[model samples]
Structure formats: structure tokens, C-alpha cells
Target: MSSDPLDDVFNLEDRFYTQGYTQGVEDGARAGRIEGRSFGMEKGFEKFLESGRLAGKAIVWANRLPKKTAKQKDASEKSSEACTLPPLPSNPRLEKNVKLAYALVEPDTLSTDNSDEAVQDFDDRVKRAQGKVKIIERMLN
Candidate 1:
């Protein structure tokens, strides 16, 4: 027995609709993943760049700190001509802040994982480092 013509026509339309929907879903899923990965990489790069900048500032601050021992002072004085930055006044609090900032954004200490906990920790460290930088700048000015 042959199927009814009208039924076949309706079934054809339904089949085409289903196929189109499936194709669209597959395409969308693929595109979404690509876009998400690209976005994630860009954001990660930006965060790391900022962290590196903060770390660099910490290193410079640490270097510019006055040497403690007589022997150290003599060594720094010899190299002081190469160092354009004037030595930071010997303030215990400033020294502490600089050290803390360096520890916060230190590359070896930070995780590169994409996990939620790792990301959160990275963000927290960066934020703390930023606060330290601001405090150091204010003290300098």
C-alpha cells in the first residue's frame, strides 16, 4: 500500500526542519567552544601581563631599597651609578609592603591552571599586589 501524498509532503517538511535544527545546533556548539577558548586565552594573557608588570615593579622597588649591611652598602654604591632610581628611604613598613607585593605576584607562586579555585587565587593575589603597589606609591609621593 502506498503512503498518502499529503502525509508524505508533511513528513518531508518535518524531516527537513529536524535536519536543519540538528545542523544548526552542531554548528553553534562548535562555534561557541571556539569563541569561548579564544576569549579565555585573551583574558588570561591580559591578567598575566598585569601580574608581570606588578612583579617587575616589586623587583625594582626591592632593588632600590637601601642596603642594610656595610658590605652590602659598599657593593650597591659601586653599582649605584648604573641604577637611575634613587634608593627608597629606609622605612621598615615600605620594605615590608614591597616584599609582600613581590610574594603575591611572584610567577613561581601563581598557578596557571584554568580551574575556578586557581583563577580565584590568582585574582586575589593580583588584587593584593595592586593594593601594595598603591600604598608604596603613596608613601613615595
Candidate 2:
């Protein structure tokens, strides 16, 4: 109680400043992480759309599904299995590439929480899938 008013005020100010600075840093870090994730997801989605992987998958799946006869489709009791699965690729290389491409283009693969990592991953996946798709298209053609 040997009152040094200036000392007390300085202590209080220093404490407040330290607390505010720490809180601000934490908040800024959290915000940055959220923004990074959002940016990554948006960019990934754009790449996914531009890649045409989904559309190609749809075409492949549609082609694989068996067509029903008009009369069979009209019957009250429909067949147990609506779509008969197609045979797997007999060519080893083609099968491997097909599997890799499908895996790369999967929904899970398109989303990442890190912007830089996501963009790089997206680029690699897109290139790999596109290459596989080209191979498949050539085979089909």
C-alpha cells in the first residue's frame, strides 16, 4: 500500500493488452483456417465440374445398366434386380486405370481442408482421371 499509482495502472494496462493480443491471434487463426477450407472446397468443386469425371461416370454407369423389355417393365411384379452389373475390364492395364480413375474422382477425393494441398491433389487427380478416360474412350471408339 506504498501507493505507486502509475505502477498499478501500467500493470493493469499490460495485462489487458496481453489478453487482447492473445485472443485476437487465436480468433485470426481460426478464421484463417475456415477461409482456407472454404476456398479449397470451392476450387475443388470447380475442378471436379471442369474435369467431366462425373459426367463420364454417369455415361459409363448408364451404359452398364441393363434395359428392360417394355412388357417386363409394365408387369406388376418387377424383376428383383433392376440393373444387371456389367463385366469387369478383362484387360489388366485398363482395369487398373479404370479403378484408379474412379477412385480419384470419388466425392471424398474432391474435398480437402487445406487450400494448397487441395489444389495440388486436385490437379494430380484430374490429370490421372483424364488420362484414364482418354484410354477408355480410345478403347470404346
In the range 120-140, model 2's lDDT, one tens digit per residue, is: 887887777777778766764
Q: How accurate is candidate 1 locally (lDDT)?
A: 0.97
Q: How many backbone clashes does candidate 2 have?
A: 0
Highest-lDDT candidate: 1
The reply for model 2, stretches above 4 Å from the true place, is 1-44, 51-89
- The TM-scores, one per candidate, come to 0.95, 0.45
lDDT per residue (tens digit) for residues 1-141 in model 1:
587768977799889999999999999999999999999999999999999999999999999999999999899989998988899999999999999999999999999998999999999999999999999999999
Candidate 2: how large is its RMSD? 9.0
